[model samples]
Target: MQSRTGARWEEFLGRLDRRLVSLGLVLFTLPPLVGKWVLPLTASSPSRALQAAVEAIPPEKLVFISSDWDAGTQAESRPQLTAIVRHLLKQKRKFVLFSVNSPTGPQIAQTTVEKAIKEEDLTEEQWKYGRDWANLGYKVANTPWIRTLSRSIQEAMKEDWQNTPISELEILKGVDRWGPDGQVAMLIDVTGSATIEYWYAYLTPTKVKLGLACTGVMAPEQYPYLDSGQLSGMLTGMKGAAEYFELIGAPSPELRVTMAGQSFAHLYIVLLILLGNVPIFLGWWQRRQR
Candidate 1:
């Protein structure tokens, strides 16, 4: 009779396990997908450091941004770029954008800037393209390209995205040459791949301050650069982007919702694991009573 009872409990638990799994999935899925919950925001130190570094650059200073991420990393890299661009635009700080690794990188960065300006309702006179900003578009993205660019900006990039002479662009006013002493106040790389390595290996010795925003996977391995002082600050993955959103004082509901989904998924998995072990616990309890 006891053996039969155990079998019954096992069967019931099997069914219960299946039901719990389904229930947990539903609970975790719906709220975030619908953006139904509000969660507290906490900005990590690295993210805050990133914002501080960018903010330290004076409005008169021009920043050089390397948009090394393609569409594959849009969810994370886009927000980082958008938030950074929005901040730069707001501060009236001019910046030049270029892409090294990906062909679509330049266009993606441009789109993000446009979206940011639109979202902020910025006026043409305030953040005018070609005057306040210039997109140098794509170029050879390797050690040799880096050497060429660092050696001479004019030789490396002669034209803008529209094929107009970069010499005529108003945004190139301060940047007659390359390196930290010229128009570039800093260099920021928002990348999804190994492109930051090139920046570190090539650009570190230059006077230009460097910063990074990369996917979570690449972030761990890249910490050594930070330790080596090659990277002034860094942002990692979607979490990093969300933290940046916090820093910019523009918290994104979509990001919060996604974070909620992630949190709930983890909790649900833990609950399922505990519940799955319940049958064994119950069996042990039964033996103790016997």
Candidate 2:
């Protein structure tokens, strides 16, 4: 009778062991998949920060945007750029956009703006180009040009993206040429490179408020700027994009849904790890009893 009881106990332990392992595997693999359903995971905070920055932009003022990203960073940069432009458009702020890195920077910037416009259901007249905003397009290379432009906007950008002179743009009419007091209301830098450092050197001293949005991996490098208040705010990665979406009260279905899956996946793996550990503990305790 005692021997039969021992055999039954061993069989129960074996079943439990198998069940725990199976549960562990499922937990490890399932969260990321289910995380898709978890809307608004880690992006909420950064999105609010960006929204606050946008709200702070004075009415009818022109903001300066340095767009230094290309197709390679579209996964991160695109959504950030979209959110920023959406805020600017909603607030009716005028802006001047320029790019330093890729030749396609201007095109990408235009696409970002257009995408926002479409998503927001805004008409062209409501946020007209050349009037509401202007694209200086891809001008010169980095740092040196940024410094030179900080000193003299006219000299820095002789013509607009379409080859139209800045002097000829209706939106730029009567705007003080980029001189010392002729500072922009704000400066937004969205880039995939460390070119942000150059803006800090050349433009920050001018007292133009600055905001930044970069790829996920670039966020760590930007913490110093945020701590020093050199950057008024920032957005990092797809999570940041989702947060910005929420802040605008225009969350994209695809982004929110995808983030949910990621969040769930993380939780699932954590639970599975704990579950798997329980069996090992029990097994070890049983062996020590012998």
Candidate 3:
């Protein structure tokens, strides 16, 4: 009788409604995403290192931002780019922006930068283009261009994204190269593609500090670089952005809500997996006794 009852219970458990499971997930996940609650998170070591690296850049040197991501990865990359940009602007760090992997990258980065500037409440006088920053836009030469960029900034390109002569930009006044002795303080590549390879192949051994902001899928591949000291630090996807926000003493509400939703959803899924296996385990135990 005990065995028969166990078999019947197992059959009933196997027939549990999929719709109910889906509904339960919705119940567990939706509230957090829609709510204003932001769970506190500790900043990871990589995040701290990235922030420290940026801070370590000398005041007079320019930070090179190679934004190589487009809308396809915006949900993750946008926040990463924005957080770094906000940090740079807030610290009054002069920088330059450009894209080589994606034609749309520069435009998207520009939008993110503008958003950051507005959020930081910076004035035109405080953060003017051609002085505080410059947009070199997108270039297509890839390896060759980067090789040229390594040797001479003046020879690599002559115009900004707006077609304005690079010579007219006060930001590039004395900037002529990128190396240990160059005017570039550090090169930060914010990308979702494999473009970092170009930097590694052509630019890594130059003694310039390098950083990366990449998607979650790309994060694992970059760990070796971090471990080997080829990279100064990294910000991986949305979670990385959130960690950065924490390090900067500014938590993003949107990230807080999104993270809470993901956390709850993950927990719910794990619980369901454990519960789903219980009936099978009990059935096996009953059969063993028989």
Candidate 4:
């Protein structure tokens, strides 16, 4: 009878229906995603520094945004781009958008720009295309191509994304080249890959300040660049995007929901860890009492 009871107890403790577990997880996680529960996040130094660097950009020269991420990394990269672009637009700064890493990056960036513009509620007269910004589209960013780009923007990109002559774009009027003495004030590369390495290797000496917004997995390797002054600033990942939102004084409801869901999921994992170990611990304690 003792052995049978033990078997019954084991069955109760050791087996859980998979569907029930799935349902429990969904129930546990969905509220935070759907509601306003958000974990408070303080802006880190890197995020702070990035915001300051962007703020310090001269109004006359244009900002070059190398939107180099595709849909795969949009979860992090899109927020980062939106935050920075929104800030730029709010400041009435002119910038050029393009992609060198992914073909779809430019399209994603264009969408992000439109979203920012709509959020700002700016009219066509206030923020018209070809005057405020231009999308130069995607290009092959090989070392030689980057080298040429560092020298002459006109030579590297002859036409805009719509196939219009770049020469006619009012935004690119004086932007014939890139460097400290040239038209672009700064270059911020938002990417998931090591595409920044091309710029770091080939275009580092031009005194055109570089910024990076990269995925979490790709962040650690680039910190040395920030510390060494090769990077003006950086946004590390989704957390970085949240911190940026804080700095800009615009809380993102979607990001808040996402972070809260992540926090609850982490708590669930901790709960699982405790549950998995408590039985063994209790067994050890009972044996010791014997």
Where is model 1 more than 4 Å wrong at Cα?
1-27, 174-180, 266-290
TM per prediction: 0.81, 0.75, 0.85, 0.85
* Candidate 2 whole-model C-alpha lDDT, 0 to 1: 0.75
Which ranges of candidate 4 are over 4 A from the true structure? 1-27, 268-290
* Candidate 1 lDDT, 228-280, residue by residue in tens: 77787888888888888888888888887776776687788897677666667
Model 3: residue 270 alpha-carbon error in angstroms = 4.1
Over 50-90, each residue of candidate 4 has an lDDT whose tens digit, in order, gives 89988998889899999999999998899999999888987
Candidate closer to the true structure by TM-score (higher is better), 2 or 4: 4
Ranking by TM-score: 3, 4, 1, 2
Q: Give candidate 2's TM-score.
A: 0.75
The 10 consecutive residues of candidate 3 with the worst lDDT sum are: 1-10
- In model 4, the worst 10-residue window by lDDT is 1-10
Residue 139 miss distance in model 4 (angstroms): 0.9
Tens-place lDDT per residue, model 3, 67-125, is 99999999889999999998998788998998888999888999899889888999767
Tens-digit lDDT track of model 2 for 105-130: 89989978887888879888877888
Q: Which ten residues in a row have the lowest lDDT in candidate 2?
A: 1-10
lDDT of each: 0.80, 0.75, 0.86, 0.85
Position 197, candidate 3: lDDT? 83
Error of 3 at 42 (Å): 0.6
Better of 1 and 3 by TM-score: 3
